[model samples]
Target: MKTYLIATLAMAASAVAQPQKAETPSPEPSRPQMRAEQPAAPKPSRGAFDAMLYVSVQDPSMEWWFNVPEGFAPHISEIKKIFHNQEFSLFPFADNAKVKEGKFSISYSISMKSPDGSLTELVRGAKYEGTKVADDIMVACPDVIDFKLDGRFPEGLYKFFISAKDGISGEISEYENHIRLAEWSAPVPFTGKKLVSDYVRAFSLQPSPEALYSIVFSDDFDLEQKGAPNSLNYTYLGFMKAAFKKNMFLISHIRDSFKSLSDLNRAKFILILAILGEKGIDASALSEPEKRYQEQIRAFKLPDPYGKWDPFLGAAQIDMLWGEFFADGTYRPVRRILNILSHAKEAAFADELAEKSRAPKTQAEWDRYMLGRLYKAALKTVAINARKYPLVEQYCAWALLHGDIPEVSYEVLSPMLEHIREMKSPSGGESGENPKVRMPRIDVESL
Candidate 1:
């Protein structure tokens, strides 16, 4: 019995010592290996943003910056009329928080959609690229973006849309606004339509002829058809500022070497003569003083006796050429051409222009006499005297549009032209019926 018990125990021990194979995990139902990553939550979608923005129809290459109205209502209605082929600037007020990244790009599109479902793309998906948040909050619009739009849209209610895309996050935010071009303010009156058509033909150029004179000389029809191009059409002041934009290409390239003021005496005189020839303004029609002056200039007509003038303008100007068209800046050339008739030209005006050119930001200190010289020179060929109220009014209208002088100064002249009187004071003053203007007491019948 003891032997049998020992064997039985050994057998039990053997049985206990024998190891069992591991059981395999049984496959229940076929299941996904990844627990289908809860399809990432859709990115946040912020509704359209209308940031504080300002538009400038200047050259496209200019440093187009951003501005948000300071806590007050924006005076967008005060914005003036715009034109075609104009460099339209669009800026979005961006801050550090919303941008989230240093680099981003904004896609811009402009279109005119009619109520009848006519979809016309004025600007389609043009990208303003390589943008970054600027250090100065005021000028946050990056230089990389093409802020200019080559104004081509016809008269219509057009929508302009801008979208910002975050490079890092792939998130997008968008903004939109609308603009309407009532009309490109043309030169006033019966003469302007014909002049504009003539300009379209005469100034017709593929890449724009090298210079104004070159265009005049190159095409036979251009010269033949462009009668009084300067006198009638403004050779140096086209609607697109084409006339006065001589060295503007340098500015377009963001180059610092732009000679705004140069010896345009030869150019000015030649252009004037060419246009005067077209006007059929008899050189004999000049007064005794002007006739004598023309005789003396007739000797040296080829090389015009142009004097010092600053054709030099920076960034922009009135009507793009109004200030220039006024010929106030053409002190030396206009004076030399007009001579005795140039009693209209004065010394004080030249000094003011020199100072202004030196310090462009500071406004010139000009007296009423100097003001007369500024406007009178432009009328050397046109204005026989101040009694020509229609001529005077025409000049006033041009000044209002182009801003030859400071807007503040025009305040003084506005009344004088309105009441058909002379400017008697520099700063504004009261009179019985009409306010006296800051002007010199001269015979309007004579220069």
Candidate 2:
């Protein structure tokens, strides 16, 4: 029994020492796995913008003679009395929100819809790139839009639209306005007397230079009439000033228009030429006008004795011609000036004028007296032949004696004097005497 129990225990130990087979996990229904959630990305910012419109008008209070009212409250819904061939201006503004780095851009398009439902693109995709914000705000606009109502557009209501875009933030703004063109009317026929009266009235009303210009150059207006020359003298100076301030190009057209006038209207045309020279129009452009003036004055045949012609008119003519001569270095204008002086001297009016100059009653008389004094001064000065002296040098000598030099002429004279001083003599000397020394020196105070 002891041996059987030992064998049974050994059998049990051998069974325990032997390795047992591992049990495998059974697959019951396969399950899917879950992933961790991620946060969302941010959105881009949108900018703000607004639109504005302005009607540009001529206001002395503003620079460049134009006033563009700011803000949207004063926008015009209907433009009135838009006459044919009359120009008008509109300013479209883009009030944009400031962007990063103050960097922004603007693009605009303008269109006009006519009464017939036809659209005319006045401005297409006008773009201003790299525009910076001013005063922490970006109020951008393209150039002023100017248009005239002509035969192309019949008198009717027209719609104007402006589309502006901000390139930086992709913002767009739009604006619309309307204008009613007036019916076309024929200009009234004006006689010389009526024309002069109307022109004088226009000055007080402060009508645009364009309106006054139309009246002055009207087809029905007479260029030759009683007091016509004097009337121009009294009013044209003011007209020219206004026109020059408003538009410099108009002055050129006005000067050239003299070419169209009839030579029979001698006195009036002469006055026009004089006014142009005084107003500082380019002398080169006036060459043809000056020629016409010379021809007309010669045909005028001044009465043999100086007194035969109206003294006021004659003196006025001389005064006007003097202005031309002073402005022009050419010989033609000065030739006429000398001719009139010689005639008055021959007629012995100089002494009488000197006496009357002391006590002048009218503006015309005062002008005549001044001419007399100028003539007397010319008489006392030594004569310089045009052939002998260079044109600029002759003018310089005259200006020195007159005690005043016009800025325009001085610009040319100053450089010339310097060049003369630097010039080497024909003998190759280091120093040379100024040619001006040959001309007689007159004390302007004595004159």
Whose lDDT is greatest here?
2
TM-score of the candidate numbered 1? 0.28
What TM-score does candidate 2 reach?
0.35
Give lDDT tens digits, candidate 1, residues 39-155. Answer: 533333442222223333332222111111111111111122333333344433322212334333444344334323355443344443333343112112322112222333345
Candidate 2 has its poorest 10 consecutive residues by lDDT at: 1-10
Q: In candidate 1, what residue range of length 10 has the lowest lDDT sum?
A: 1-10
- In order, candidate lDDTs are 0.31, 0.41
RMSD of 2: 35.3
lDDT of 2 by residue, 197-269 (tens): 4553433223333454555555443433355453444223333333334333344444565555544333343
Native-vs-model 2 lDDT?
0.41
